[model samples]
Target: MIYSSEHFSISLLQPKDALQLNKLLVSNTERFIRFLPKTLEENTTLESTQYYIKRKIKSAKKRNEFVFIIHDKHSIDIIGMIILKNLDWKIKKGEFAYCIGKRFKGKGLMSKAIKATTNYVIEELGLETLQILSHKTNLSSVNTALGSGFEWQATLKDEFKPLNKAPLDMELFEFSRPDRF
Candidate 1:
């Protein structure tokens, strides 16, 4: 089922969306890589992306991971994507990740999307804590996490090495279920 709100709708990524998804990733690769691992943008091909998305959808079903596309209601254009992965039912925790197209930045679209997606993760998926990891250099991502109610956590030193880049520090953030607040 699609999750809808006044500003945007979150829906499962489908096979038919392959072309559009590829275009979205290609167009936003530079902006996306600033916060994500650089390897995601490097060596990306439509076919490989298609394969990856298809696998994510299947994995979402099996592992309770949810991958959603954030779309503008009026324009029907995809603005971003959010992923909840590694759902551990015993711990009631999951890893959260997201990317918004450059064109849609600073419009509060991602904050809305995060609110909607987190609601689903909590109400529908029964998750308690959402963990978000981002590069220290990406302030926008850090802002998004904070805006979405994630608390700042300690930084991990030299935890990740982006493709073709030196090891970098990563900031770990956490947002708990409202009841935990």
Candidate 2:
């Protein structure tokens, strides 16, 4: 599914995007690690990124997860990525996660992308509820969640432990599909 906004678009990461994703990750290593250390640690090279993308494709084909890459509308550059994961088919629930390149920070691109993806999954994929987990210290992420209509559901104690750091509390935000009928 491709979702287009005024300045950016979100779509599945094609195999051709591996190299660009690698470069983007390398350049934003510091910023990314601040929020997404594990993701950065895994996709440290073009080969690893290709492997990750392949895995995403497999998961997508199986209808287990969906990963979307955010691109600059004009340049088509890879600027960020989002995932709808940990889907529970019986309850129609999924967790969402996302990260943006440092250069793309403060552009409101992620908020737009999040809102678009959340709507797509709920409306098109028949997901009943979506959740976003963000570290309490990450105000930008919290803002993005709230801006995209996700309400604060709870504070999960020690939900995430960043590398070499004490376990940090995480805020759980959720959005439920509105009654349409």
Candidate 3:
């Protein structure tokens, strides 16, 4: 299902979206290098992006992970992506990882995208808790999480390790639904 607002739309990443997704990542490579290291390496080429998308589609079908594309409302251009991963079915929990093109930042787009995806996890998918981990210094991500209604939970020291980079500290933010009770 697709979610939308006046500015953008969000939906499952489809096979045909490989090219657009690749472009988005290529353009945002430097910005993503620190937090999205593995993702950056996975989509470094058109063919690799195709493979990544296929894997994501299969993962979604298996209910293990999901990748959603964020697009401009006026066109099909992919501007960002949100990943629902690190899922723990037994604990009813999951973590979100996201990124948008540099041109799309500072416009409140990611925050809305996060909220829509979070609703899908908590309401439709019946997950009880959600988390977003970002480097404490990444104010944009930190603000986006807070804006999307996720509360600061804790600081996880040395929680993120980028390729060949020193381990970095991350701030954990969480949102949980009580309706399951």
List TM-scores for all candidates, in order: 0.88, 0.94, 0.96
* Model 2 clashes, total count: 0
Which lDDT tens digits does candidate 3 get at residues 105-179? 999999999999998888788899999999878999999999999999999998988889888889999998957
Could you give candidate 2's per-residue lDDT for residues 91-166 as a string of tens digits?
9999998988878888788888999998889888899999999987788899899988999999999888888899
Per-residue CA lDDT of candidate 1, range 1-181, in tens? 4588777788887776676677778887777674565326532787877887777778887977777888777775778888887688998999888988888888877877787788888888788999888876677788888888888888989877776788888899888887875
Off-target runs (Cα >4 Å) in candidate 1 are: 34-43
Clashing pairs in 2: none
User: Weakest 10 consecutive residues, lDDT, candidate 2?
Assistant: 33-42
Kindly indicate the candidate among 1 and 3 with the higher TM-score. 3
Better-scoring candidate (lDDT), 1 or 3 = 3
The candidate scoring highest on TM-score is 3
Query: Global CA lDDT of candidate 2, please?
Result: 0.86
Model 3 poorest 10 in a row by lDDT: 172-181
Q: What lDDT does candidate 1 reach at residue 111? A: 75
